[model samples]
Target: MPLHLPHLRSVINSDGAAIFDAEQGTLTTLNATGAMLWRGIEQGHSKEQLLQSLADATQLPEEQLRLDIEEFLEQLTAQHLITSE
Candidate 1:
């Protein structure tokens, strides 16, 4: 699946990222890890590429990272912050 963000504005920093949904008038803050994932999504990375890249960067197991990514995706979907294609 591919992910898409609609009407969102974001600012990323060394510490984290802050995303604003202009349509919903809501703000979301993400930690460093989340920010990395968000950036990957913005770059149009596939789920597998994201998992592998994050695993290499963090030296974490791919299985755990996959679960984490899935959970994060679910949260974004639930919040209507992203749509999948």
Candidate 2:
């Protein structure tokens, strides 16, 4: 499934990112790492690609990153920040 951001507005900076969901009238903040991952997802990167890139960038184990990414995606979904299509 591909992910889509609906009615989204955002600002990404060196420190972090702030995303506003116009549809939900809510704001969410992300750390630098989360901002990077979110950018990759917005650019249409696949889940596997995101895992590899994060693993390479952080030099962390893919297994742990996988769990973290799963959790993050779930949060995004629960917040309606992203949708699968």
Candidate 3:
């Protein structure tokens, strides 16, 4: 599945990233890990690629990274920050 962010603006800094939803007027902050995942999605990475990258960066198992990424994607979808394409 492809992920899409609609009417949202994201800013990445040294610490992490900030996301603003213009349509809903909501603001969200992401830690380094979250920012990495968000940027991966924004760049049109496949799920497998994302999992591999995250696992490499965190030194975690692929299964664990998969679960975490799934949960994060769910939250973004729930908050209307992202949609499936």
Candidate 4:
């Protein structure tokens, strides 16, 4: 099955970011770049979608964002903020 990200609830702050799972009582932190990508996700963005969006928003190339994008997705997925579907 494909991973999905629609079940998450997120909030942004000056210091960092938070993705919360109400059922689990868990909260995750996002670094500067991770915060950017997490905030960019809306209705439809895959891991690649986040990478491209981050590149465009930061004026960086997709290749430059690739590794970080993959890492971010990993963290999100590990925490159930996103799915692997």
lDDT of each: 0.86, 0.87, 0.85, 0.69
lDDT of 4 by residue, 18-82 (tens): 88777677878877777777666544566667767777778876776888777767766777776
User: Taking the tens digit of each residue's C-alpha lDDT, what string does model 1 give over 23-81?
Assistant: 88999999998888888888889989889888988998888999999999899888777
Pick the winner on TM-score between candidates 1 and 4: 1
Deviating ranges (above 4 Å) for candidate 2: none
* Tens digits of lDDT, candidate 2, 1-85: 3385758988898798999988789999999999988888888888898899899999998999999998988888998888777
lDDT of 4 at 72: 67
- Candidate 3 global CA lDDT score: 0.85
Clashing residue pairs in candidate 4 are 2-85, 3-83, 3-84, 3-85
Higher-lDDT candidate of 1 and 4: 1
Per-candidate RMSD vs. true structure?
Answer: 1.0, 1.1, 1.1, 2.9
- lDDT per residue (tens digit) for residues 1-85 in model 3: 5475768899986688899999989999999888888888889898888898898888988888889889988998998888887
Top-scoring candidate (lDDT): 2
Q: List candidate 1 stretches off by more than 4 Å.
A: none
TM-scores of all predicted structures: 0.93, 0.93, 0.92, 0.69
Mind sharing the TM-score for model 4? Answer: 0.69
Cα error, residue 82 of model 1, in Å, equals 1.0
**10 residues in a row with least lDDT, candidate 1:** 1-10
